[model samples]
Target: MADDNKAHTAISFHEAAVAAIEAQKERLVRQVTLLQSKRAYHLSAIRYYKGLITLARRLPPEVLTYIFQICIDLGYPRTPLNVSGVCSEWRKAALAPTLWSNIVVDPDSDERSLQRRIKFRLDRSGLAPLSISLSLSRSAVFMNVLAMLMQHTHRWSSLYLTAESSQEVDHFLGIFGRASFPLLSNIGLRLSFTGGEVPLGVDLQEPPLAFGDAPRLNRLSFHAIIPQSGLFYESLSLLKITSLILATTPRHQDVELLRLFTCLPLLQTLILKSKISIVDGDIGTIAEPVHLSWLRKLDITGEIEMLNLLPFIQTETLSHLHLRAVVPVSEEEQVQGSLADCLHSFIATQGHALEYFELHGFYLSAVHMSSYFTHLPNLVELQLHDSDISDEAIRLFSGPDACCPKLSKLDFRWCGQVTGKAMVSMVQNRLRGSHNLHSINEVTLIHCSFVQEADVLDLAALTICRLLGKPDDYCRGSTCCQNERYRQRLQLRQMFGVGGRVRKLTKNLIL
Candidate 1:
C-alpha cells in the first residue's frame, strides 16, 4: 500500500508540469501573431512612403519650375516647349519670362527655317530684355531677315556677333544704327577677313554710328577691328566703357594704337594685343604718357615692343600689371630699349600705387626682378610663369629689408631653376622673422623640378587650414582665432579624416 501511494504522487506531479508547459506555449503563439501583424503594418507604411517619394506630383512648384528651366538651358529639342508636353505644371514653369529671353540665331541659317523659330522665341520672351547672339556669315539677306525682330531692339541687354567677311560686318553694324539698344550693357564682336574681295578700307571722312545707343555699355571686346578700323574709337567715345579689350590686327602701328586708347578716359581695365605695323613715313618714337587716372589693371601679351608703350601710359590708380614677353620675328622690329626702364618710368608716376605684378614668358634675371620689387615697395602679389627664376631671385624676399615686404602670395610655374633650399628658407624665414613686416601667406610652386615633396609640407598646413576662408587678419592667431567658427575650422584642420588627407596631399602637390 505504501509503494502504490508513492507512484500515484509522482504521476500527479508530472501531470501538473505538463499543464504548465501547454499554457506557456499558447501565450507565446498569441505574442508571435501580434508581432507579425505589427511587422506587416510597418512594412506597408514604408512602401507607401517610398511610392509617394518616387511620384513626381510630390515636388514643390518652385523646384519643378527650376527643373523645367534647366532642361531648357540644356537645349532640349524645342526647349521650353519640350517641358510643356510633360505636364501642366511643367508647362506653367516653362512659360516664365526669363526662360524665353535668351535666343541664339545663326545669321548663316536659312531665313525660312529661322523665321518661325525667331518669332516663337521673341513672342515667348515677352517684354524681357533679350540676350541675342548672331553667328553671322557673308549673308546680308540673313541680316535683312533678322531686321524683322529689330522692333524689339530696346529690349536687348547683351549682344554677341561673329562676322567673318566685310559685308557681314557692314550688315551687323547697319542694324544698330536704325534700331536702339537702351538696355545693352555688354557686346562682343569678332570680325575677320578670311576670303572676300571687300577689304577693311573705309572712307575716313565718314562719320561713325553712335549705336542708338549703348549708353549703359560698360564692357566691350572687339577682335580684328582695332587700329585697322576706327570703328571702336569713333563709336565707343560716347559710352562710359570701363573694361575694353582690343585684339587688333598683327600689323597695327604701336603709336597709332596708343593714340586710340586715349579716347576712353573712364577706362578701369585695358587689354591690348597687336603686332608691329609697317607704314610709310611712320617713326618708331612714342610721345608722352596719356593719363588714365581710373585704370587699375593692364594685361598685355604679344610682341615685346608692346612694353615700350608703357612709358607712354600714366595711371595714378594703376594697381595690377601682367606682361607676357614675345620676341618679334624681325631683328629691326624689336622692343625699344629695356622693358625694365619703360616699366620703371610708368611706376615712377604711380609711386607705390602699383601693387600686383606678374611676368609670364619673359626672361627675367634675379637683378631685374629684385629691382622691380625694390621700386614697387607695396607689391602684394607676384607670379612668374615659364620665367628664369633662381634661388637668388627668390632669396630677395628672405632678407631683413626684402623688396616686397607686403607680399602675401607667390606663384612660380615651370621655373626649372627654383631649388627647394631657397624656397624652404624663404617660407621658414617669412613664418618666423617677418610676421610683423609681411603678410606672407601662401606659395604655389607647380611643375618646379627642384621643389620636392618635402618642400610642399611647410606650405600645405597653412593652405589646408585656410580652406575655411577666414580673412588674413584671422590667420595671425589673433582674437578672431578664438571665434567659435574659426576655432572649429582650426580643429577640423587638426582632426583625422578629410583634414588628414588634405595634410597628406602636400606630399604629392610638390611633385
Candidate 2:
C-alpha cells in the first residue's frame, strides 16, 4: 500500500507539469507568430522606402549625368554603357558626352564586338573633348578603328599610346599627317618591345614622328625610345613643354643629350638618363650653366654622373633632387664618397636650395655622409635606397649638432649594413633626450636584413602609422586594416625568449 501511494503521487505531479508546459508553449507560439508578422511588415517597409531613393528619383536627370561624367574623369571602372543599363534615366544620363569623353581602345581584344561597344560610346561622346588611350601589340592591326577615332583629333585633350613594337607605333602615328590636335595637353608614349630587353630602343631613322599641330602640349614622356634623326628630336623640342622625361636605351652621348636640353627653353621638370661622366681633364673651360628658371624638380636616374652634369645646370628654384645612382661596375669603390663631396659642392653653389634629397643605389659609408651632413640643413625629407649605411652615420644624424635639423622623413630600403641596435639607440636618443630634440616624425625600413622587426615596433609606439617589409607580407594584406602589421606583431610572442608571453606593452612604454 505504501509503494502504490508513492507511485500515484508522482504520476499526478507529472500530469500537472505537462499541462502547464503545453499551455506555455501555445502562448509562445502565438507570440512568435505576431512577432514574425511584425518583422515581415518592417522588411516590406524598408524595401518600399529604399526603392524611392534610387539615383533617378533622388537626383535630377541632368545632375545624374554630371555625376556620371565626373566618375569618368576620375577613372570610373565600368564603361558608361554598363552604368546606363540599369534604368531608363541612367541610360539617358550615360548618353552624356562627358561620360564617354575618355576612351581606352585595345585592338588586341575581341576586335569586332568591342568595336561596336566603343562606337556606341563614341556616339554618346559627341562634341566633348576626348582623351584617347590606346594599347597595341606586335600583331595588332586595327586601321579602321584608328581612322575612326582620329576623326576627333581636334578634340583630343590627352593622348597615351603604348605599343609593343616601333613598327606598330609608327604605323598608328602615320595617320597624324595634316591632322590637328588643337587641345592636346599631355602625351605619354611607351615603346616596349614584346620579347626584347628593356629600355627598348626605337630607331627614329624613319620619317620624324610629328605632333606639331598640338600647340598646347605641356608635358611629354618617352620611355625606351631613341630618335636617330635630328628632325624627330627637333620637332618635339619645338613645343613649349613644361615637363619632359627621357628614359631610353642605346644611351645617347653627353653632347647629343645636352643638345636636347638646350632645345626645351621652358622645361619646369626634367628627368633624364645620366650615363657619361665628365672627367676632370675632359671638361675644358666650364661653359656658363644653362639656366632653367622655371625648373623646380630634377630626377637624374640611371648610371648618373653626379659630378659631371650638375655643374652645367643652374637652377635657383630647384627644391627636389631624386638621384637614383647606378654606380658603374668599375667605379663602385669611390662613387659614394665622390658623390657626397660633389653633391655638397653642388648645393653650396646653388645656395642650398634643395629641400628633398633622395640618393639611391649607392653604397654609403660614414665617410660618404660626413661631407654632406653639415651642408644640407634645409632638407625636410631623405631617402637612401640599397645603401651601405652604418651605425656611425646614424649616430651623426642623431647627434646634438647633426645637420638636416628640419628632416622629418627617413626612408631606407635594402640597407644591408645597418644593424638594429644602432637604429634603436638613435631612436631612443630622440625619444628621451632634450638636447638634440629629435624631430623625426616618420621612419620607413623596407627589406633591411640586419634591422630586426622588433626594433621597428619600438618606434611604432611613437609613430602614428608604420609600414614594414613588403606590402605583400602581412597576411598578404588581409589584416592591413588601418595599416597594422599582423604577422609581425604576432611574432612578438616568440620574441619573449624562454617565456611564451607576448610582451606586456602600454602607451608611453618606449618613453
Candidate 3:
C-alpha cells in the first residue's frame, strides 16, 4: 500500500508541472495578439496623418490666384505657377491673364507654338502692360516672330531679340523702322553672322538716334560679333541709357567704342568685355579712361590696363566693383610702373566708397591690402575666388583694426592655406570690442579640407555664446574634444554603413 501511494504522488506532481506550462503558453499567446492589434492601430494613425498633410497642400483656387499675382510681381515666369500641377481647380485659376503678365519666347520654339504662347499671354494680361522676351537663334524665325509681335510692341516693357546675320538684323530693324516701341525699356540682342563675315548687300547701318524722344528707355545690352564702327556708337548713343552691357568679338574698332562711353553722362552701371584681337597689341591699353560720376557699379573682364584707368575713376559714387581674369603685370612691367601700381592706388583711393568688392584670378599682395582696408570703412562684403595667399598674408587682415565695422560676409573658396585656427583667431580678434560676435552672418569655406570638424564646432560654440551672452559649459568640458569626431562617425555610419539599413536602437534601464 505504501508503494502504491508513492506512484500516485509522482503522477500528481507530473500533472501539476504540465498544467503550469500550459497556463504560461496561453498567457504569451494573448500578449502577442494584443501587441499586434496595437501596432496595426498606430500604423493606421500614421497613414491618416500623412494623408491629411498631403490634402492640406491642395490650396483653394482663391489662395492660388493670389499666389499667382505675387509671382507676377516678383518677375517669375507663369508656367511654373501652373496651378494644374497642384490640383485641377488651381489649373483653371492659373490660366488667368493677370497671372501671365510676362511671356518669354525661346527662338528655337516652333512658330505656331510661339504665336500660341504670345497670344495666350496677351489675352490673359488684359489691358495691363506686358513684358516680352523674344530670343531667336535663326533669322527666319526671328523675323516671323518680330512681325507678329510688332502690333503689340507698345505694350512691351522688355524685349530680347537675336539676329544671326546682317540680313536678319536688317529685317529686325525694319520692323521697328515704321513704328516705334514707345514703351520698350529693356532691350538685349545677340547678333552673329555666317561665313565669319558681315553680310553683303545689307545696310547694317543704324538709324539716327531716335532714343532722345523715348524717355522711358533705360537699360540696353548688345552682344555682337561685328566690328565696332562709328554707326554702332551712334546707334547706342541715341538712347539716354542708364545701364549698358556690351560684349563683342575681337575687332580693330576699340577706339570708337571707348569714345562712345566717355559721352554717356547718365550711365549708372557698365559691363564691358574686351575681346582679343591679332591686329591690336592689347585692347586694354586702347580703352579711354573717363571719370564716371554717375556710375555706381562696374564689372570689367578680359585683359585691362588697370594703372592708366584706375586714376580716372572718382570713388565717391562707386559702390561695387568686380574684376575677372585680370592678369597682373610681370616684374619687368612692374619695374616700369605698370597698371599694377595704379590698381593698388585706385583701391586705396576708392576703398572707402566701396560696399562690396570681389576679385577672381587676381593676385593681391600684403602691401596692397594696407591701403585697401584703410579706406574701406563701410565695406560690408568681400569674396575671394581662386586666390593664392599664405597664412602670413591673411594675418594682416586679422586684428580689430583690420576688421570692417560693417563687414558681415566672407567667402574664401579655393583658398587652401587659410587654416581653421587662423580663421577663428581672426574672428575672435575682430569681435574683441563688440558685445556680439555673431555679427558675421555668413562664412563660406568650400574646397578647404584643412578646416576640421572640431574647428567648426568651436566656431559654432563661440557664435552661440556671443549671441546668448553666456558661456557653453558643455563645450568647455574635456569630453567636448571627442564630440565632433563621434558626431562625424555617426554621420558616416548613417550615410554609408553595412547592411544598407537604418534602425533606431533604444535601451530601457531600471535603476
Candidate 4:
C-alpha cells in the first residue's frame, strides 16, 4: 500500500507539468502573430510619408503636362512613351493632345510597326497642328508614309521633306501642288545624293507650283536646290517669306538674281551658298541696287570673290555678316586682287552698320585689314577661322591709332599664322584703357597652332578666355594650348641634354 501511494503521486505531477507547457505554447503563438501584423502596418506608414515628400507626386497634373511638352520640344521624342510608364498620374498627364504634336517618322522602322505607332500618336494628338518631318529615300515605304501623311495635310503646321533625286523632289512637290496646307508656316526640302556628288555644272530646274496655297508660310529652306523665277517665285511672293536658305551653285546673271531678291520684300535673314562668278560675260550695269531695308542677318558661303555681290545689295539695318571661303588654296593668290577690291567696296558701303563680323579660310593682307578695321568702327565682335592673318594685322588692334574702338570680343580658331605673343600684346593694350577703347570681355582660341600656355594664362588673368570651350575660371592649372607635341619635345630635350638620346625620345613628338 505504501509503494502504490508513491507511484500515484508521481503520475499526478507529470500530468500537471504537461498541461502548463501547452498553455505557454498557445500564448507565444498569439504574441508572434501580433508582432507580424504591427510590422506590416509600420511599413505601410513609411511608404505613405515618403510619397508625401516626393516632388513629382506633389506637382499638379497641369504642371506635369507642361514639363512633358518641354522635354518633347527639346528633341526627346521618346519622352511621352517613357513618362507614361512611370506612374498612373504621369500617364494621365502624358495623354495631353499637344504633347504628341511633333511626329518624326523613322524611316528604318518596320512598316507595320511604324503604322501602328503613328496611328497611336495621331489618335492621341486630337486636332493639334503637327510638325511633320519625312526624311526617306524613294521607295514603296515612302509612298505609303506620304499617303498616310496626306490624310492629315490640313493639320500640318511645319513640314520637312527629303528625296534622293530631283525627280523624286518634283514628285513630292507635285503631290502637294493641289493639296492645301492651311496651317503650314515652314517648309524644308532637301535633294540628297547617296554619294554626295551632285553634278558640278548642272543647272537647277524650276520646281512645279507647290505649296502655292500655304497662306501662312514664312520660312523656306532648300538644300542642294536653287529657286528659279517662274511659278515657284510667284508662289514664294504670295507667301511673303521672311527667311530663305538656298544651297546651290547659282548660274544666273547678277541683275536677274538681284531682281529675285527684290521680289521678296519681307526677307529678314538670307543664307546663300554659291560659287559666285560671272556666268558668261561682264555684269551689265544694275540700274538700282537691290534694297533689303529689313535685312538683319546675312550669311554667305562662297569664294572671296562673292563679296562682289555685296556692292549690289543695300542693307542699312544689317547687324551680322558671315563670310566663308570655299576656294582651293592654290587659287587664293590668283583671286586676291578681286577679293581686296570687293572687300573695299563692301566695307565702304555696309561696314558702318555692322556689329558682328566673321571671316573664314581667307587670306587678308595688311592693306585689306586696315580698310576693314577703319570702316567697321562700330564692330563689336570679330571671329577669324582658318585664316592667314599676319601678326602685323593683329597689332592693328592695339597702339594709339587702333581702329574698332568698340570691339569687345575676339574668336580665333585654326589660325596657324597668328602667334600667342601678338595676341597677348593686343589683349594687354586693350585692357589698359588706352585711347578709351572698350575692354575686351571675351576671347576664344581653338586649334590655334602657335598659342602657348603662358599666353592663355596671361589673358585669363585679365579677362575671360576660352580654350576649346574650356573657360579661364574653369580650366586654370590645365594645359590650354594646342602645341602639346612641341611642348613635349622641349621637356624631353631638357631631360636628355639635347643629344642623340633626346632625338630618340622625341621621335614620336614634333621636331
* Each model's backbone clash number: 1, 0, 3, 0
- Give one digit per residue, the lDDT tens place, for model 4 in 1-511: 9999999998889888888888888898888899889989999889878776788878998999999988887689879899999877789989988888888765566776777778788899999999998876556766776688789989999988776666666666777887888899888877666665554322333322577667788888777655555655655566678898877653555565666677787999988887655222244254357888889899888766566777777888888998888763332463376656776787778878899998776766656765677888888998876655668877887888888889998888767778888988898899899997888888887677788755665676677776543333212344543545645655666577664332222222222
TM-scores of all candidate predictions against the true structure: 0.67, 0.65, 0.67, 0.68
Clashing pairs in 4: none
Taking the tens digit of each residue's C-alpha lDDT, what string does model 1 give over 1-511? 9989999999999999999888988899999999999999999999777756764657776777677667666665356776778665567777877778877876456666777778888888889888877777545556554776688888989887776654566665765676677898887777656754433332221114636566788887767764343654565566678898876663545555565667778999998765432222223354445788899999887655555677677777888887765442222332234655666666666647777887766665556555666667788887775565778777888677776778777877657778877877776777775535574676766556787644556556443212222233212343422234533453455355443454444432222
Deviation of model 4 at 287, angstroms: 9.9
For model 2, where is the 10-residue window of minimal lDDT? 473-482
Tens digits of per-residue lDDT for model 2, 332-380:
4646444555666677766376788777666645576565656677778
Q: Which of the two candidates, 2 or 4, achieves a greater TM-score against the reference? A: 4
The list of candidate 2 runs beyond 4 A from truth reads: 1-100, 124-129, 135-143, 162-180, 190-213, 228-237, 273-290, 304-312, 325-351, 419-438, 449-454, 469-487, 490-511
Root-mean-square deviation (CA) per prediction: 12.1, 9.3, 12.8, 10.0
Best by lDDT: 4
Please give the lDDT score at residue 45 for candidate 1: 95
- Model 2: pairs clashing at backbone N, Cα or C within 3 Å: none
Error of 2 at 457 (Å): 4.2
Candidate 3: what lDDT? 0.59
Worst 10 residues of 3 by lDDT: 465-474
Deviation of model 4 at 28, angstroms:
24
Considering lDDT, where higher is better, how would the candidates rank from best to worst?
4, 2, 1, 3
